[model samples]
Each structure stands twice: as structure tokens, then as C-alpha cells.
Target: PRIIVRAIRTAGKLAVDKVKELSVKIDNKSPEEQRDLLQKCAVTAMSSKLIHQQKGHFSKMVVDAVLSLDAPLLPLDMIGIKKVSGGALEDSFLVAGVAFKKTFSYAGFEMQPKSYDDCKIALLNIELELKAERDNAEVRVDNVKEYQKVVDAEWQILYEKLATLHASGANVVLSKLPIGDVATQYFADRDMFCAGRVPEEDLRRTQRA
Candidate 1:
């Protein structure tokens, strides 16, 4: 009976101690102290995870993630983790803003500027490529000049559409459909950034950000 009584007292003491710890407001601590505490907590939380071996890196990422959000109650739903294939576990990182892996293309990708500051972004669902005149529409050109005019008209329509987009003061362009080589080169020539085939989820998240 004495042993059971002693165990009950110890359990009560532990509970009281935990309550006191929990009651302490983290904001009351200094920035450096808070960071240290969070790092230790992150390490402990991931002790059983596969990333435990790289705790130092993962710990910093966790601390950054928490500090960046800076919320009284964590809005965990706002944070997203995308597990991309390839690269080591050490390659994992936390982006303060949204990022996409698959949307960028090789065409004119290297020519355009990579980073932007306070730049306007335009999200489009329409294709930038030249479209057919109409469904089941056929044009019987009598001569070479006639065929050239038909081609020029289609090209002019594409060019005008691109010009209209450029006039919108958008330096960054994202589209759900293919932007194609012609449109890609157009943006690159102006030192702007453009990407096509962007996922719908990415578009929504970008808008929110």
C-alpha cells in the first residue's frame, strides 16, 4: 500500500511540473532562447523519423518554419510539404513562399530572369499557341500569296494576344495550357519569367500568397 501511494504522489508531481511548463508563454523568452528551445523540441519530435540522422538541418528547417508563421496557434494547414523524387534527404528545405517543381520548361527558361521582387504575376488558362480558325474549317488558297496571308493572320492573332498580356504590367506569366516556344521566347526577350502547365493547386496557393 505504501509503494502504490508513493507512485501516485510521483505521478501527481510529474503532472504538476508539466502543467507549469505548459503554462509558460514562449513569447516571453528571448529570440535566441526561443530558437534554441524550438530546435531541441524539433529534434526530440523527429528522433524516430528517417531524417533523424540529419537532425541539425531538419531542426533548423523546423525552427524556420515555426518562426516564419509566427502565429499564436499554428496554422498547420497553411504549410505544405511536397516530397519530390530524387535528391538526398539532406536536400529537403522549407520555402517561406510557394514553389513549383514541374511547371518550368527548358524552352527559353535559361534566357529569362529567375528571381523577381514585387513583380506582377499573371495566371492564364488560355493557350498561347496559334489556334485553328474553327472546328472542321478548311481554307482553299488559290495561290502562294493567299496561303501566306492566312498564315500571317494566324500569327498576327497570336502576337496580338501576347502583346495584350505584356501590356497588363505582368512580369511573371503562368498558364494552365502550353505557353509554347514562341510565347516563351517573347517573355524571355523582355527579361520576364514565364511558365506553362502549372498545376491548379499551385495557382491557388500562389494567389493566396
Candidate 2:
């Protein structure tokens, strides 16, 4: 049997944040004041229990699935390993087989999202393609918790680098591509995030976990 990790999206709650801000009231506020308010609100949301909530919700389901793969590419390391959290991918098939599925599930994909007119096709194809890899190959997925901590440790270093770059105001457009597809958008997001473009609160939440 093929094993795959799946993540579910959870509703978020802002503990102190049921306050309704009317657009009119926001409109009356100066731009500087508005920026300040938003900053504070963002900080409050991060500081409150809501930070990294989705991660905790999702990781619980995905960690073991990640371990079962025969091979996996880590975004931070830019290489494939013989196992899910260590080593390197020797071929495109290996990367496609393991990394692709995890990325797809992480985005909270499903048949429901597939019906949307604007839903990204590349992302869906990623899921389909990885499933194909699993069926075509003899590889087996296993548990990766121990190696995952090391991978995560490296990922954090990369994330801090990217976050600092983004904070310096560097533009984050795709630098080069062989195909025109949002197909790789998540990879880009993961790379930047591994490098550190995820919203700060999200990063902090991951750090705490």
C-alpha cells in the first residue's frame, strides 16, 4: 500500500479579536494610523494562541506519512536523500514521487478545490503526478520524525536567511523557470520560506513548536 501524508485546514480564532472594524472608520483614519493599527493587530494575533495553529493542526496528520517515503527532497537543502529526512534524490522521479505529494497536501488540496475555475492546475497535477510515481515505483514510505527534527533545524536556518532578505525589502519574483506554471509556486513559497518569507507570526509559531 502507498502511504501519503495529508493536512487539513482548521478554522482560526483570534482570542481578543471579535472587534468589528467598519470600513468607514478605517477610511477616516490616516494611512500612517491605519498601518500602525494593522501592525498592532497582526502582532496581537501572533502573540495570541492563534499563531502557527494550522501547522500544529496539519503536522499531526503528515509527519508519519513523510517518514514512509523511500526518497524525499528537502527545500532547504536543495538535494534529495535516500530517506525522507536525510540523504538525496538520485533522479527526478524520486523528487516527484515524494516531495510533490507532501507539498500538495500541505496546500490543503482536495476534490472540492478541484472544482473551482481559478484553482491552480499545476498544484493538482503535482498530486496526481506523485501518486503516479508511487504506483510506478517499488519505494515505500516510512516514519521520519527523528530525521525530521534535523531537517527542520536546517530549514530554520534557511528560513531566517530568507526572512532577513525579505525584511531588507528584496523582491521575490521567480528568477527562472523552464515552464510557465504556478505548478512551482509552492516550491517557490517553500524555498523562500525555508530561506523565511512566511508571515513572521507563522515562523515564530513554527519556532516555538
Candidate 3:
């Protein structure tokens, strides 16, 4: 068929043709010009949204958020969005840096330090809950004395892990796993900030920040 002949000729020509890069490079633009362009693009993108009337506010926030990144590659995952109740769309402004809500799994969270300056932060993926091994192995104990030993062993393991964490001098401890009552009390006793069950995205951003 004529179609097959045309395809063959086109393929032969393509095989002899040189490839060209098609990605746009916008590095020539000045910073101010780039910011203006981003603001305009942001406003245009939001034109169909409910808060289009507040495009000016949101567009400025978009530009500020993009400009705040200190990396060579801009990733959308690095940005976080938290919704606080009782705030108008116009009041929705961008936070300059990473911000997440407080989630306390245990009591005495108030006893911990409210804030820290120049303090080391540690990100953990391990669990600090005082429970049996994650394997769910049942302890076979016939008497109260043996049960006491089992509980003590669990406490000792938790204490060793906490001790290692404390030795790192990280006042702010954030973990993806659960940090239960005993760990929370230990942190409060030491006047350390501890937050558990943090989202992986927030942890990544915190690491970068």
C-alpha cells in the first residue's frame, strides 16, 4: 500500500536525521523578570478556581514559595499545604519555611520545651513504643516473677534506645513511627521536643530545611 511505502521512506529518512534537544532553557531571564512571569502564570492557572478574585494574594505566595527553595532542582513534594480552620481564602498565605501541626500521642507534651535555637534535630524511622517485639511473640511465663522479668527486659531495651538517642544531643526528635507514653515521659523529663507519626513528606522537607 502507499501508506506502507510512505512509512518506510519516512523511517529511512528518520534513521539518517540528527536528533535535536527540545527542552526550553530559561536561565537567561533576570530574577525579577522570572518572578513576575511566575506570578502571572500562577494567577492564570488559578483563574478557574473559586479564589480567582484573590489571585493577587495567592500568586504572590506562589512566587515566594518557589523562590524560597535553595536547591538546584525544584520539586513539588518539598512544598506542604496545611489547612487551618476559620481562615478566609485571602488570608491563606504561604509559610516561608516548613510548618506542621502538633500531634501529641501521649500526655505531658506541654512540659517539653516550646522552642529551640540552634538545637540539633533527629529524624528516626524506628518505634519507641514500650511493647513486645514487633514479631508479636507471646511471652510464656508461669509466675508473676517471670512476667516481671519480661516487662523489665522490654523497659531495658527501650531505655538503651532512648539513651542512644539522648546521647546524640538532638533536642527535637521526629519519628515516622509511634513514640508512646514511656518515651514521651522520658523526653519531657529531659526537656526535649518529641513528635511522632510525622508524615514522610514533612520529614523529607525538614531534612532539606
Candidate 4:
């Protein structure tokens, strides 16, 4: 048993060495020759019975997704794959821009804007909600009138932030943090596109685009 184990380990080492030798040979080749070799290897590997039969189709989908970026060097991390179990592989397609799963905080907002030709976007790292300076502050509200005034003051501050965003000629607002209902309603009233609570990485990619 010990002899068999030793022999198997030796064989594994030899296999790894052989792969390293082949990689060095490939690296020493011209760019054109290396590309040709890579293409041939990919084709041969895809032809193996153990592999998925539709790998070529999936490969094309990946290639198309990367090419859609239109950059000389690909930012592959920006490519997002959304898999649905019931769909055929052929039904898969690539989307040009960043795709994110988010919903409008306000119910009445339109999913998309009517015009995008002159759309200027604003990206906000801060939340549209108002933050209290003191978490535990004692407010002496004598009556309903006083309480109403306090609530209105908070709303006014949130409104100002929303107004500032709109005043900046921002047709689309993307926030990395949550946007309050007041802010969302304000944006909806102006027919502006607003998305809140977006992932930080996605926001960075959108800024780059």
C-alpha cells in the first residue's frame, strides 16, 4: 500500500512538471502563434465528452458581453451573470450597461425616464433621510401644533436635499444609501429617475461609464 501511494504521488508530480514545461513553451511563442494555440486548445477541450455540449454557446455569450464594453482592455468584473434555471442557454443575452436589482422607494415613480438624450446623472454617497444630532433628545411638545411643526421641519430638511439634487440638472439620481419616501416622492413628482441603496461597487462602475 505504501509503495502504491508513493508511485501515485510521483506520477502526479510528473504530470504537473509536464504542464509547466508546456506552459513555458507556449509563453515563448509569438503572439499570433500563442493565440492560435489557445484557440485550438479551447476547441479541443470543448469537444471532450465530459464537458458541457453547449460550452461554445456559453463562450460566445461571455465573449459578446466583454466586447460590448468597447474598451481595449476588458473590465471583466463589471460583467454580471444572472442565471435562470428554466431558460435555454440559447436564450441568454448580454446587457450593455450595469444591471442592478433595486426598486423605487416611492410607489408612483416611473421605472424609466421618458428621455435620456440629455440626461445628466448625480451619484450620491449620502442618504436622503435626515439624521438627528442627538439620538435621545427630550423635546417638550406641549400640543399637537408643536408636534406638527417639528415633523414639518424634518420634512423640510429632506426636501431641501432633494431640491438641491434636482437643481443640479440631474435627470437620474443614484444613491449608495437609502432614500426616504419624501425624497422619492419629490423625484417622482418631477419625473426624474431615482435609484437608492445601490451596491458600492455597482455605483463605482456606473460612475466609470
Better of 1 and 4 by lDDT: 1
| Tens digit per residue, CA lDDT, model 2, 1-209 | 12222222111223223334332367788866765565555445545453344433323223333333333432222222333554422211223221221222233122112122322111111011111234554533366876577556655654554444445543321121121222233334433211112233323322232
Question: What residue runs in model 3 are displaced by over 4 Å at the alpha carbon?
Answer: 1-26, 132-136
Model 1 is weakest, by summed lDDT over 10 consecutive residues, at 70-79
Estimate, for each residue in 123-163, the C-alpha lDDT of model 1 and write its tens digit.
Answer: 88988886557878999999999999999988998999899
Q: List the residue pairs that clash in candidate 1.
A: none
Off by over 4 Å in 4: 1-51, 68-74, 84-86, 102-105, 111-115, 129-138, 143-145
lDDT of 1: 0.85
Q: What are the Cα lDDT values of the candidates?
A: 0.85, 0.33, 0.86, 0.75
Candidate 3, residues 1-209, lDDT tens digits: the string is 99999999998877666342434445898888878888988999999998799999988987888788876675877889998999688878777777888776688777889788998899999999876565867679999999999888888999999989899999999999999988988999998989999988889999988
Count clashes in each candidate, considering only residues at least 3 apart in sequence or on different chains: 0, 14, 0, 0
- RMSD of candidates 1 onward, in order: 8.8, 23.8, 5.2, 6.2
Q: What is candidate 2's TM-score against the reference? A: 0.19
Give the Cα RMSD of candidate 3. 5.2
Q: What's the residue-level lDDT of 188 in candidate 1?
A: 95
Residue pairs with backbone atoms closer than 3 Å in model 4 (clashes)? none
**True-structure lDDT of candidate 4:** 0.75
Q: Worst 10-residue stretch by lDDT in candidate 2?
A: 121-130
Give lDDT: candidate 4, residue 88: 70
Estimate the lDDT of model 3.
Answer: 0.86
Maximum-lDDT candidate: 3
